[model samples]
Target: MDYANKTGGSAQKKKSFAGNKAALIFFLLTVPTLLLYIVFFLLPLGMGAYYSMTDWDGFSLSYRFVGFKNYIDILQDNRFLHSVRFTFLYATIVVVLKLFIALVLAIFLSGKLKLRGFFRSVYFFPAVLSMITVGLIFNQIFYSVFPSIGQALGIDWLSRNILGNKSTAIYGIALTNIWHGIATPMVIFIAGLASVPKDLKEASLIDGATPLQRFFSVTIPFLIPMLTVNLVMAIKGTLTVFDYIVAMTDGGPAFATESMGFLIYKHGMAEMKFGYGTAEAIYVFVMIAIISFIQIKILNRKEAGQL
Candidate 1:
């Protein structure tokens, strides 16, 4: 009995030592990543929050603490308010068009068709191009090519540059964004479609379900997770849009295209209202967090129900 107990104890010590070694290795591997995240992300975020409450001009070394005055002033700023409204409107238009068009293209491309691979490559190619380059290309198309075509066709409205008019400028930018943005979402939807259970599709067919019925009932349920991802990405990207505006409009036509991102850059960098701009940036962060949280909860609930 004593020898048996000794042997058992030796084996147990070996297992415990092996477990500890594995844990030590994991800790060592994670430490560098944790340090990097803290230094780069968390540290800057903390500094920004602190600076937002001060009255620091961008170039000034000395500044006074102003409490929430910057926040209060932002609420009363008409231009900022207008930009907020325009941004939300822009986001709505872009998100809807992107998802709808991408889904249609994805469904079409996923089917058995001649030259399917070629079409898929053509659709996804746009996603790999630089966004600013695409914007510049489309700017020329809207300004020159479109007007020429419209003149030839004798269409009065299109004969004019769409970006020159305040009413239609947002739509012009949205058209460019949709053309460039649909590629990623289309790829995601294609992947989701591929993952749908073949057996479920066959069952639906055997039960006399029409194509539309099968799509709505079988395919859509499998696509809910992908839809949520695309929605979140679309909303976040559009809300903080900057590059396209810079390339295409430069917030022109009397600041009609000024987005929150552009406003932040204008104040923080150009006008040197560092504190106020930081405050505005904080507000944007909060707004994004709240909206994204609500979206995730609703979508997760819907996904669960579908399951």
Candidate 2:
């Protein structure tokens, strides 16, 4: 009947209107975040690109366009190359150690342990603290008190300034970084572990699987997705880490502890070679992107058992 058609058409129109209204609300809600992202992230990237083509010092009024001269100089710079090498080494060591420690802690805390909440909070509390503060505190631990304690135990551990020594300075920085960054991954892994199927664990145990076997077979397989997320984060963290390095080492005892990030700061802001710094920044971005892509691909293939 025409009356039925009219009602149906009215209902369809209402649904369409609702959909449009929802879309409008969604757009409005996201507009603030989009604007903030553009202002903070995109705008800086654009300016960095422009600056990389010039010889602009930080306080300069004008700068001459140097094309890719700055980039070429960086490629040929021995110090820069050395810094890049050390950055890779630093990143690799920290990622491996931090994840291994975090995984162990997460697995332990995921079980029916006493004071689980307290332990989780204790572990995660460091992540919430300022990196500068953590660096300073850990410096004391490494320098004065730790050495004193070691001497008491006849360890002779602090024969030299760990933070100021050329040989161990990079490792020292990585240790501080691992301490600060481990909590984030631990919390993530805990969430992942908590979500693992209880039935799956029970079934595996029923089949006479030992604790280690059940973990390796059931728990770890389920953790692949979470591991992907953590690995991505750790790699990015490795490349972009700066504040703790600044507060603790300042690329100390020469350039032994110099990371790409600190070197960028030294050039762009501290040393006032803005153009060169921006070029370095872009290079770092490219490196991080490539590294992250390779890691994600490898992780995905491993999860798919294609490795």
Candidate 3:
């Protein structure tokens, strides 16, 4: 009894010491990150919120509190409203097309194939290019390459340059975004696919399950968590797209391609409507938060049900 008690006491003491060490290590790792978040993100966010309520141009020493005037003005601003609509349409198209292509590619590449690594690298290569570079390159393709190809093929519509037409300009931008953004979700889905249990796959095959059945029954359930993550990220990232729009359309051809980010840049930087732009920026944040929250909540519910 004495030996057992002594051993139990020593074990408890060691466990307590180990717990203390883990807590200390966690604090050390996280404190710097917390400090950085406060200094960089929280501070700027607070300042921007404060400025949004004022009549301060970005470069002014003296300004008065506007008392929700900026927010009210933005609601009446037609250009801002149009940009909001355009952004929603653009984000939806881009996310849907990108995710579809990524899923297809992930499924294909995860299969046994020749030069699989090479194919993956080829598909993923465009993602490494800067958004500005992608936009500029595609701009050239639309303006010069397509026109040349159209002329060669005697196609008048293709010769006319899609970006110049307000009707097709957003689609052109969406295509560009899809081309560049597919790799991210593809990689994510590949990782999820790798995590699927091989034994389950084998059992499905042994039971004479068709490929589609196995994919739907076995693979999809395992991919739910990753799908949730990718969905939220894709929505947030696509909504706030900046450099691609700047280089490709510059919200041009009568503001047809103007996104929320482009509108904020135009107002805050170009027109120097700082307070109003800050108000719009806050709206953008709120929109992202609401949409992301709803998507995550829905997806998590689905995932829980699947499990």
Candidate 4:
């Protein structure tokens, strides 16, 4: 009895020490990560807020602080307004198209497709490539190969110069972004589709329902959450579309394809209006926040069956 009691007590003490050691290690490990997050994300956010209230020209040490004037400029400026409008248009179109494509591809891929792994890799390949590289590749294809093909077919595809034409420039960027990003949603949708219980599907088939009915009534209802998540991601991606736009048209064709992100870059980096540009950034930040908030509320209500 004494030996057993001693062993039991010793084991308990050992476990206690081990648990304490593990907890301490975890706390230590998370501290640097927490600090890095605050430094990189929160610090810049706070600094941007400060700069938004000033007219710091980024060069002079004594630039005058102008309160709310930069925001006023953003509101009244025609180019800025145009950029914002164009960005929304681009974002909406790309998000819808990308989601549709992703859903379709995911359905097809989830089934017994041959060489599934190979095909998935192929579809996702463009996403891994650098935006600069993708931009260059698309530029050549749009400007050169497309025109050449047009000549062969006598279709005059080169006349509009898709990248240079105002009407089509944004769409061209959207197309490239879609190609580069479609894989991400495809992967997501595939996971969502997989999570769906097969028993539900089998039960639907036994009730003399058509395949289409099963998908519309049973499958789609469960997929709503996945759709919401994907929509948010696509919205975020569109709002921050920069490198691809910069590489393709440089927000050219008379500022036709200029997105808010590119506009921020132009002001801050190109024009050297650091604080004013930070003000624009804050506006963009607010826009993203508001949209995301609205989306979350709507989706949450839907999830609760209150929508």
For TM-score, the strongest prediction is 1
Per-residue lDDT value at 249 in model 4: 94
TM-score of each candidate?
A: 0.90, 0.85, 0.87, 0.87
Runs with alpha carbons beyond 4 Å of true place in candidate 1 = 1-25
What's the lDDT for candidate 2? Answer: 0.85
Provide backbone clash counts, one per model: 0, 0, 0, 0
> Residue 253 error for model 1, in Å?
1.5
- lDDT tens digits, residue span 177-198, model 2: 8988899999899988988888
The 10 consecutive residues of candidate 4 with the worst lDDT sum are: 1-10
Q: Give the runs in model 4 whose Cα sits over 4 Å from its true position.
A: 1-30, 158-160, 300-307
The digit string of per-residue lDDT tens for model 4 on 1-307 reads 3333445556786665666666688689899999999999999999999888888878887877788999998899999899899999999999999999999999888888789988888887777899888988898788888878778788875644699888988888899999988998899888888877899998989997897998897888778878988998999989888988878999998988889999998998889889989999999999999999999997898778822
Q: What is the C-alpha lDDT of each candidate?
A: 0.92, 0.85, 0.88, 0.87
Q: Which candidate has the top score in lDDT?
A: 1
Q: Give the winner by lDDT: 1 or 4.
A: 1
Give the C-alpha lDDT of model 3.
Answer: 0.88
Clashing pairs in 2: none
Over 163-232, each residue of candidate 1 has an lDDT whose tens digit, in order, gives: 9898889999999999999999999999999999999999999999999999999999888899998999
> Model 3, residue 184: what's the lDDT?
88
For candidate 3, the per-residue lDDT at 64 reads 90
The C-alpha RMSD in Å for every predicted model, in order, reads 4.3, 4.5, 4.6, 4.8
Identify the superior model by TM-score, candidate 2 or candidate 4: 4
TM-score of 4: 0.87
